[model samples]
Target chain A: MNKYISIILLLTLLLLPLVIYEDNNSRYEKLSKSLLCPVCQGETLFDSPSEYADDMRSVLKEQIDNGMSDKQIMDYWTARFGERINTNPQNSNYFLILFPIIFGLVFGVLFYKKVSND
Target chain B: MISSIGIILTWFGFLNLILMCFSNKKNLFQTLVRINLFIHFLLFCLLEVGLFLDDFSLYYIANHSASSTPPMYKFASLWGSLDGSILLWNLVLSIYFYVYVKFYRATTELYDIKIFAMIILFFNGFTIFSSSPFSGCIQLASIGCQDFTLLPFQDLVLSEFGRGPNPLLQNHPLMAIHPPILYFGYIGLVLPFVIATSELFNRYKNENWIKIAEKATYFPWVFLTAGISLGAAWSYEVLGWGGYWAWDPVENVSFIPWLLATAFLHSSKTQIKEKTLINWNYVLACLMFLSVIFGTFITRSGVLISVHAFSNGNIGTYLLIGLLIFTFLFMYIGIKNIEYFKTSRKVENIFGRSGFFVANNIILSASALIVLIGTIYPIFYESFFSRQLTVGRSFYDILVGPLLLILLYLMVFSTKIAKVNMNLKKWIIENQNELNISLIISIFLTIYYRASYKFVLTIFGSVLLIIIIGKNVISKYKKTKLQGSYWTGQISHLGIGIFAIGLVLNVTQSFSNELIISTGDTVNFGEKEFIILSPYEEIKEEKNVINLPIKFNDKEKNASLNIFKNSSQQAISSPAVFRNIQSDTYITIKVIDDDKFKLIFRENYGIFILWLGLAISSSSFLTRVRK
Candidate 1:
């Protein structure tokens, strides 16, 4: 039964993108047209047929088909490039940066107390 | 000469600020700040005009300028680069510097204000000299480095038209307003730093600084929220994702500061309630400022390449130093004044909303920090290990999702929990009255969409939020609408709830397709179908595009997708939908394969609520004028 469920899950995952692939592409197309290409300053990937975006699109299409998930793809890229390929960088690695954050809060609280007391 | 003048003006700003600090003269700081402001304005005009006039002799202009780039874009290009953006930032800073000084001139707090101005001036001056937006571009040929500078005007190498703006930015009008609004929010944060320092120096500690800072903070926080919302709005309309906020790097940059500001707001509430939180308030202010620096770093450094980032040459070292020195100065001042943190307040109401508000700030910061780490880890990786790693949507969703749900839960219950000034027993009894039955009904109404199998989990999340909002609204209406802050909070929270619902719906129910279908072509999707009747073409001075109207027949209703340009041009979906009722749909058709065309269907609801949230949150500023 577990094996059957696993196969079913895999199939379902595969089918999900098939159903939504068109939607994803339209979304990409719309977004590509609207946002500036980060790699190429002035042109949109939608407007300019650059090889870089073309490669990214192909990779995106493959990921959609593989249904490997965003984490898997991100992990793969992290492995391939280290940590900078992420469109959104998370602040986990240098968590110590928050030391300043903590200090700021402490100071803010102190300032509030003294002001309110007066 | 202009650069020298700018340096002199910066020194003048510093000088006036210094005089204000030591002088016992009445309103000395105010007078000095005003003088400094005039000097800075003249300097800014002197510097920017060089670029605005396309004086290629100036390295700043040459690097950013191109022959084919239009005059209008040239003007916009002033802020299109990092050094320039920072320059404009100081210009805005000077405006606020004088205005704040002038407004508070008669007030007893002068030394604190002077310190704040001095700190800002030092940081500004250091960055100007180091990063120097006017720094002449290095000759790549001479240096033997490949030419990488984005020349603004250039002869079309392949076509008559210049490569259009990031397809994302050029795709919509919202792009124009979105960044500036975010900038306003970012800059507004500097004022809180000044006020916090002012309070510490005054030794006249009271709710006054919190009260003043709360108003100052809320205006920008509100603008920041609106700015974020409009970006999402632009995304939904222009990106064809049927959703806003892609969890992209640029979006994350806007979001992080917003989260810190939110924490600052909630912490202020704690201060107002128990007149304490000495350590915590400083932390929140510093976090907000840090977020501003971090967000700017992410955008300008050209380190994190994403659709939302603008490409100026590498500015990592410049950004890091600026962030470091500013933070260090604030830390020194705050720690030096540790005498002010003697009294600690008792947690009178852990079961109450005030406690919950503190928890909310914690959650907000934690989530923002997680995003911050994921966003910048690659930079560290590249700098140290010579490796580049990238984190994306799934990482954030998994990490922050549970915490956010808890936040949502707190938001739901906060309206019911009374504290401090409220008569809790009587308030509860009144809330329990017959009027609450309507709330129960509305809560059920909020759930209706989620109960449907066709709907997603976010629908229920939205419903839960709406229900909580319903309870709060019903309770508030029972009381008078006289308190502006209370009403403002009400509208703001309600708008947030509505926006939450809209966000969930947009993310879940949106539809997209990319294909090749032309005029008179028909494509069927799920329950909806699109028929392309005709194609229309439009040519402007800068843009050339085709417009097509497609008719949609779905479970919702018959709608049309207005799409133009696919292979040769950018795709634009002109969704003709207008209403605040929560669920609205727009359809656009893009011709990809001639007969096999792409169709995009999207639904955006609750944006009107987002705007309403802006209205209510911004109203907190009105309290400044309150008698």
Candidate 2:
């Protein structure tokens, strides 16, 4: 009984993503969070309560209603406000994110090898 | 006159520390340390009295406090700015030093005291010479005080009435306690580093230092957890943003030390039990201390753009130099005594308790490194590429999220493994029933809620972790009555599981909407209908508060804004929260006109669970300390 229940739960979890659909509201939230409020310090558009953020949110709503893709909407903001508008680093700076992971992997491997060898 | 006394005491304390570092006689050294501690305690008390008395002759009080400020806020005003905060830091450091000398002196050598004294002397010197709270306007004039108009010899009163504290600092009661608690945590980290570094320098081969260092780390680790949680609660309550934990530079820097210290705590356990990872524990202790200095630099130097950052000053350069000196010193000692702590024991099995500790260390260290990189990347990028960039929450969420998930997975399984060697298949077979039940509950909840993929995964992992911990705790309690360390460790891990669950639910299910409404206007969102009642104003001592009462469903709540009656006319918002076990209805009001107001209504789910988890996790330390 436990094995069957575990298998069923595992399968359901694996297939759960397929059943989840993205709506425009969630997309709008995602877009607003991905963009920073230019007027506020360290606040995203969704989080900032400034009048400028309100206007930007309205503009974002309009763009989403006009059926722009996520990339296109992102590009629209980045082109207007430079690359700093987007929260994620640029593609060229991907190495900055990978540096720590690679370092952790190397350290783990070396430590594990030493311990296992002894 | 009191300000002059404070200045004299600060100088005396500085000199005392310096003398204590050089004194070879143990009696003289102890005397000097006691005097140093006494002088700082006197200085802090003097500063607090000045604040409470509204002594405008003192420059810091005149700038930070007003006569009309409440007694609680007046007491808190000691750390309301940079200079006074440094005084608070020094005072806390003095207390820690006294406690160490009085209690743990038997385990420590004279050389350790000297090294620790040098550190104390540096900080004391920094406090006195660079950012003295005792300076009056006349002394401040030499440092380019823009508002100074008096002659050097004239009575250095700048204002008959003070300016009061920062509006944000005075806005919440939690501000009174958060900084002091956090300062204690930050300053307490130095002891472990001092112990470890001194041990390395002395070429001590015994494992007794590990016990002392681990004990030193536990209270600070608990305080850091509580401090960070209080800070998050303060942000959520006072910032009117309906969110906690923004992954800001200052916040990240605080968390970096915490993560490293937590890693040290876990690995130090392995070192004590199995005599492995001895060098790793020392490195972690040093890194934790260095990270605290780096965090202080990031917060005080104005190098980062954060709401929590202090004003830019020359102290940044001094702190950076201090950091470099300490880093070089630690690296030198670490290299010179690297072979002293080399372990000869082997882990015969990768699936055992030791491997789990190793994996835990790597995951936590990686998480800290990723956060550090995300935090300082923009600074490096701008300096090197001449381009401005913002590494925001998404950067951290993308990189550190998977690492945390892996950590949770390890926490779930690691407890079930044997100490030295374990048969993985037998362990799995033994825990199959519990595993399946956890999966079923998690999946059922996820399906019922229709959560996103990331949310689903987090919920699953958290549920599994909680179940494993709960089972282990029950079985262990029934078997032989759980040990102190084991009990505290399991409870803290259980708290993490609950915290993770609360975090995911709050992030994924929470929603906020803004509406423009006037008096007598009714707005509807979802099933709840909110009617704006008449707004009223109240005069509260130093400030005027405008409260907008709204009736949502069956309950009435007020979202108020405080307008301080100072020259600056600073306004702060106090959001109204209708809270329950499952969710909170948070409302913040912004007055556009006499009758018009813009309000943001946020429904935050599982916030109570988050606080509950923090309470459990932090309180476990108290139990262990008692034991």
Candidate 3:
């Protein structure tokens, strides 16, 4: 039971970074930079000066000032611009994040078992 | 006229390769292929001449060249765009084909050579049809265009120059060699795959085939290692972002193949020990080549957005078709030869050398899978949902980071494991003294430096690991004549350790911030002082280039950084780095106006160790070829 709880706790801690809210300017800048600017050829929101990027920036600042959380702001944009605005796949496509770890562990065990059986 | 010769030669080369594939006169066909390779080389020479002559009649030269451009840049411009870049790729591929035929033809299977010849023909056909540098110029009136003016084409023969290479391409000298070296690595991958697949077709049991494949793997592996290092170096120097890798799609695509190839190398070793991994070897070989093709498709597809990806159309579909055909064909072979994969002998110990390789491959393949999924997710999202969902760096970091840590753990401990059973307690008991000493040292250093507890743990682990491996290597070197492969593996593992240490230090201990400063302002960033001397502006053609001279950490030498406002009126910051053995002080300036500028100051502690590690690892591949 303790082992299971520890595993659960570790997983929650890993997911914490995804859920944590940013209240500072640097974090905001980093977040904005990761978001793609749809109007530009190949540029992030922070790097582009396209009208859409400018509008998105305005929205970001507006939400931040209004005490809106990061997820709230992200979802707001997702709703407005469709899933295209969600730069990184989030809650809906979390399996992509989990697949590698699970595969690694499974393969590690199978390989270890095969090697150990003399 | 000269450019047309390149096309004619390329067509003839393709014809010769086809003939070589079909004909019974093998020696005659091989000689013809060699001669055709010469023609390919000559064709590239003519193309270079056309570029140098500023021949506007050649469409590629007119678009990518200028009379006023420096001689070095004009030559480098050969790969600045799509058509010319394709031509360069073909040149490198032909060169590799020539070398392979001339040297390895005697020992290598004929089927391998024939298949390779066919691959060469396919690439030749693609180059000719999709991106032909020989196509006539859009503006033929300005033939022999040359000039000293900014807009020289307006004045015809007196002043008829083309636009210079892209500002981004011309910014660094590394641009000239980086692409070609990378292409060499990418195209060199074709040989091993063709050989491995040919084995499936012939069912030939030649012992020399594996040796041939190993040779093919090592040389290209060296080039790929060098190419990746050069790319990271280029990014560190050129991209003002102050980061070497961003987990960008294009970066991920290139990395996937390298990972697969790494796995292939290990599995190939497994085949030597047990011969069980033969089928896995073929699969990996196919995947490595397919991943290269996938990388090519991604870069040219325009399906995903990346700063470094090429802008092209229809080529992606053609490449996708080629990929599908090859993948299905390889799949068919794999299924037919399914029984060959099973081994009669079982692994005696889980902690043996072969066992270590199995674990290593597991991590490698998993990591490759992670990268592949992360890279392809956006494409899938876009295709299925008609939504542009980007897989951010955080996703990759979360997915790949722990796996790398596991890999590092396995790497450090594998040496010990190779000599023991799966008894962790016994292993720890034997090495406890050295481990404790290293652990204490790491703890003290971490505390002294005010690093995080996690960092302390990582440092402790790496130090303990390194000490154990280093001690073993030193003792081995003293006892016996050092085996080339053994030493190379040790060096490469050491490189991995060093790189991990650098990455940990840079990520956890670095300090960075942006400040808007004016002349004579001394800004304190972390522990270092940056003094902005003065800002000056100069007009280079249509762009206003702003220069900032900075005194870093009270150093006597001042480095001047250039910032330019391009035609789009966006300020582009070019960072100047003061590289030292221990650390690097990086600074980038963005022009706010004449007197004021936005300065990004970053001090990365021990980041040089990362490059040092990469260099050490890359050079180790050379040792394999030494004898």
User: Which one is best on TM-score?
Assistant: 2
Of the candidates shown, which would achieve the greatest lDDT relative to the real structure?
2
Better of 1 and 3 by TM-score: 3
Look at candidate 1 and tell me the lDDT of residue A45.
36
Query: How do all the candidates rank in terms of DockQ, highest first?
Result: 2, 3, 1
Candidate 3 docking class? acceptable
- Could you tell me which residue pairs clash in candidate 3? none
List model 2 lDDT by residue over B11-72, tens digit each. Answer: 77877877777777866767777787888888889999998887777778877888888999
Summed backbone clashes in each candidate are 75, 0, 0
**Candidate 1 overall Cα lDDT vs. reference?**
0.56
Q: Tell me the deviation in Å of residue B160 in model 1.
A: 16
Model 1, runs deviating above 4 Å: A1-118, B1-27, B42-75, B104-110, B126-128, B131-176, B201-207, B239-243, B311-314, B381-386, B420-479, B551-627
lDDT of 3 at B43: 67
Please give the C-alpha DockQ score of model 1.
0.12
Compute the DockQ of candidate 3.
0.25
Q: B271-314, model 3: which lDDT tens digit per residue?
A: 66566556567778888888998888887778777768775567
After TM-score superposition, the amount by which residue B261's alpha carbon in candidate 3 deviates from its true location, in angstroms, is 1.0
